[model samples]
Target: MKKPFAIVFLLILSSCQYFEKQVPDEEALLQKRLKEINWKEVSSYPSIAECDAILDKELKKQCFFESMARLVQEKLDLDTIAMLYPEMDTINVQVTVYPDASLKFEPQMPPDNTVSYNTIAIDSILKARLVDFPKIEPAQKEGVPVTTQFILPVILDVE
Candidate 1:
């Protein structure tokens, strides 16, 4: 009886190691992928309302977009990215086309009430652009490049 019990205990312990999953090293993967990122074509886009929200919020805080506009990088979906990283100042986005491709107006924040889907944000930190990263490397599936979208945080100097 003792021998049988010992064998069973050993078997259970040995099998537990097999249940553990080895997660892929994402940091190394991102570094390699960002190197492959084509940087010549980034752009910025914002609907009047979208920019306004950021401006209104900032201005209300006594930090105007005009004074902080230089720090804007690109716009991103706050709701979407915020879910992944609760403390992230910005989201991780990749894209091939520039959001500024068709934006001909001044790079200032939008006024009180215009809305646009292509628009993201500009804050005291960086400005973000909205674009579709045509191909997300190492596709989620084994054979297809998943169209993963994100906010590519841009760093700028407001001071």
Candidate 2:
């Protein structure tokens, strides 16, 4: 009876390893989850007060873009960009929204080198005219604020 009981206890202790779960490595798991995330897209887009009421995600994004483009167009219309580059009807502006809600605008040069414009002058003009815009809420990814950048085509309709 004693021998049988001792054997049974040893067997139970040895089999306990099967029930013990191997703890997963947290760093490895985090890396896997990070890989699964789509880094290109943001959870929420940067927006102005006018776009806050929009509930649909896509529509909200569209509203923000359109509003920005309109504001930029209106501002640049007051500048001499149209006179300086009469051949250019539209300019692509690269807008960057930082996590701190600050904005930066850069003039995107034409892909074809044949179309040449003074980039430094254009940049200065943009900086001067595009200031004092309505406050913008920064974009977010996974509920954390992030920097986002996109290009907007602004029509030169100063006439």
Candidate 3:
């Protein structure tokens, strides 16, 4: 009976490794979390002071976009683009907001190369007219500011 008891105790001690839990690798866990996050979407959209008070995410974004479009339309309305290209009704402006709260505006050229619009003049006009805008807060992702780019279609109602 004594020998059987001693053998049982030794077996239990030797099998202790089976009950021990393995710690997961931190680097591997971090990589898995990063993969799960959607990099394309931002946690917060860029906003102006007017849209800052809004708590709803979608509404805030809509307000910002509408404000931008309205400003662009007002600015371009004063330009000679309509007189130059009477047939052109809308221009797609690519607005890039950098992490440092800086902005860049570029005119997106039409896919058809045969179009007679002067892209250089349009780009210059966009840069010149789209100035003196209200201070813009940069977009954020995971609590860090991130660069975002989007195309805004500005209608030219010069009539």
The whole-model lDDT of each prediction reads 0.36, 0.94, 0.91
Taking the tens digit of each residue's C-alpha lDDT, what string does model 3 give over 51-120?
9999999999999999988988999999998888877888899999999989999998668666688989
Query: Candidate 1 versus the native: TM-score?
Result: 0.20
lDDT of 3: 0.91
lDDT of 2 by residue, 1-159 (tens): 999999999999999998898888999999999999899899999999999999999999999999999999999999899999888889999999999999999999788678789999999999989999899999999999999999999999757
lDDT of 1 by residue, 1-159 (tens): 999999999999999998897876999899988787655422222223224455343343233223222222323333243333233443222322223322112223324254332233322222334333222122122232233223333332221
Note the residue pairs that clash in candidate 2.
none
Stronger candidate by lDDT (1 vs 2)? 2
Q: Identify the candidate with maximal lDDT.
A: 2
> Where in model 1 is the C-alpha error above 4 Å?
19-23, 32-159
Segments of candidate 2 deviating more than 4 angstroms: 1-19, 112-115
User: Which candidate wins on TM-score?
Assistant: 3
Better TM-score candidate (1, 2): 2
The lDDT ranking, best first, is 2, 3, 1
The alpha-carbon deviation from the true structure for residue 110 of candidate 3, after best TM-score superposition, in angstroms, is 2.5
Q: Each model's RMSD to truth, in Å?
A: 19.0, 3.9, 4.2
Clashes by residue pair, model 3: none
